[model samples]
Target chain A: MKLREIKEILNAEVIVGEDKLDIEVKTAFGADLMSDVLAFAKAGSMLLTGLTNTQVVRIANVLDIAAIILVRGKKPPAEAIALAKDVHIPILTTKYILFETAGRLFAKGIVGCLEKVEAGSERI
Target chain B: MKLREVKDILEASVVVGEEKLDMEVSTAFGADLMSDVLAFAKAGSILLTGLTNAQIIKTAADRSIAAIIIVRGKEPSTEAIEMARELQIPILSTKYILFETAGILYSKGIVGCLKKVDGDFYK
Candidate 1:
């Protein structure tokens, strides 16, 4: 889905990257632990997170992740917004919780990124 | 630099992704805290970390990071290695600590990912 579609679905307010809303997103990952996001988020995927800190934008920039949707109606601080704007990372705010937001997106065909690893196959 | 060059420079042991030794790396980031690595690691860059866990490999896989080098001679568990191999993330080990490893890489022209944010013009 596109960032605009995601925004409409979530009823979100775009805090940055308005010009880049046309970007395409194939998958979505939601997590509060930055570590988990870094370990599992696929490139071009959208991140739905509640952790409103500067690190989130930094992580997004490094991974080339599409955008960030802050759940629970949380507004990130000035520092976070400024950093995000500088990097052109779209930051959105949503009133729904992470699980709810993810459910809605999944129902809309926005899939998650977990690959099915074989039960005991040890090869890469 | 290529992962082969990195292994040579760090005198690292390749635990996985040996077939990917030819991969190119443009940047390097060293951190033990997974959050810090997530926040700063550029894609296709090498990560020098002392923390050995499935989470480290997971983070590198998520960000498309090129490889992970465990510093301080730390060895990851079987699960971590298995996970990294599944993701095709090269895992290397070095006896040097994080600081020493970073210095060697920087001297060898490996740059970090800190951009210059303006001087408190805090907009």
Candidate 2:
């Protein structure tokens, strides 16, 4: 889905990057732990989590994730937002709890990263 | 600097979760482009960048970074903030441009990620 659609689906507030709401997103990964997101998320995935901190942005930058969805009505500090703005990563906020948000997005056809390895890969 | 000190140094505004400002930060990596941050940043480092998007948060989470610093006076969107809050990663902002921000921090003794191979490792 496009980021604009994600906003509508989750009833999220946009804090910055209003100019890029229409950016395309192909997949989603939901997790609060940074290590899990790094080890499991596929490239070009969108992250859904409840953790709010600067490290989250750094993780996204390293993993090449497409976007982040903040659940349970949390708001990042100004520094976090500024970092996201600097890196051109789009951030989203939703009032729904993490489970509810994930369910809603899942119902809308967003799939999570799978355990399957790619065609040319022999291991996960 | 500790996250609290970083906040004071940059004279930035805090949007939420004041409970974590004093977190310690040992190193920082600055970039606006997500691709570069991912390719070059060291593990356990803090990210400094100008891009405000969800992907930046995702990158940080993946890299095990301690914090993020927004340079050139940018603000992350609410969605971005929410994501960061969920991850418990501290973020900071400064009005200085990328070069100036990096220089100031470097002058204060923060070093970049260096290419070092371990002595015990085999090539």
Candidate 3:
């Protein structure tokens, strides 16, 4: 699905990268733990996170994430938004809590990048 | 709903607080971020999270959470289990991803303790 559709479904406000809303994403990884995200999130998957810090923007850039969806109505600080714009990473904020955000996206055919965690952080 | 009912719905295991399965919980707050959980989680609500560290137990204890539901098939660290035992907080493990877990629980009438975050973490 395109990021544009996701913005509509979640009633989110685009904080950055509005020009790139046409980006297509089929998989998503949700976590507030940045280490878990770095370890497990696959490239190009939409990252659903509760953290609104600049670290999120940096990590998304490193992982080549399609976009960052802030859950629970959390908005990134100004510095984070600035970094995202510089990195060309899109950020969207939604009022939906992390659970509902994931549930809604899953209902729309978006699935987890991985269903379960295996030992050693390896996809077994 | 009772913790037992949640277990049945999510096919979860009672890793701790097994004897307390009858405990009723109608609200939940899901997040892997400890700070967010601490800031927003209300007392007596189930905590749905992807994190399994001992910090989770400590945070839940400080906030007086009803139970901790470890989603995405993640198990609490042994330290977390021990702490939960000492704190008397129930810990449940489920194979469903966080999203699926929330969907099922919401379908069964467990709603978010706080639907959205207001400014300055006021709500």
Winner by lDDT = 3
Local accuracy of candidate 3 as per-residue lDDT tens digits, A1-124 = 9999999999999999989999899989888888878877888989998898999999999999999999988879999999999999999999888877876777788887776665654443
Measured with C-alpha atoms, the lDDT of residue B24 in candidate 2 is 73
Q: How do these models rank on lDDT, best leading?
A: 3, 1, 2
Fnat for each model: 0.00, 0.00, 0.51
Encode model 2's per-residue lDDT on B25-49: one tens digit a residue. 6666654446546755667776766
TM-score of chain A of each: 0.90, 0.90, 0.95
Decoy 3 TM-score against native? 0.87
lDDT per residue as tens, model 1, B17-105 = 88999988767665566765675566887777767889889998998888998865678889899999888888999765443465466
Candidate 1, chain B, TM-score (2 decimals): 0.90
Considering TM-score, which of the candidate structures 2 and 3 is the better prediction for this target?
3
Candidate 1 lDDT tens digits, A24-113: 886776666676567666678788776788999999999888899886566799999999999889999876544346656666777654
Q: How well does chain B match by TM-score in each candidate?
A: 0.90, 0.82, 0.96
Write the number of the candidate with greater TM-score, choosing between 1 and 2: 1
lDDT at position B122, candidate 1: 32
User: How would you encode candidate 3's per-residue C-alpha lDDT over B34-68 as one tens digit per residue?
Assistant: 87888889999999998898989999999999999
Which CAPRI tier for candidate 1? incorrect
Off by over 4 Å in 3: A120-124, B120-123
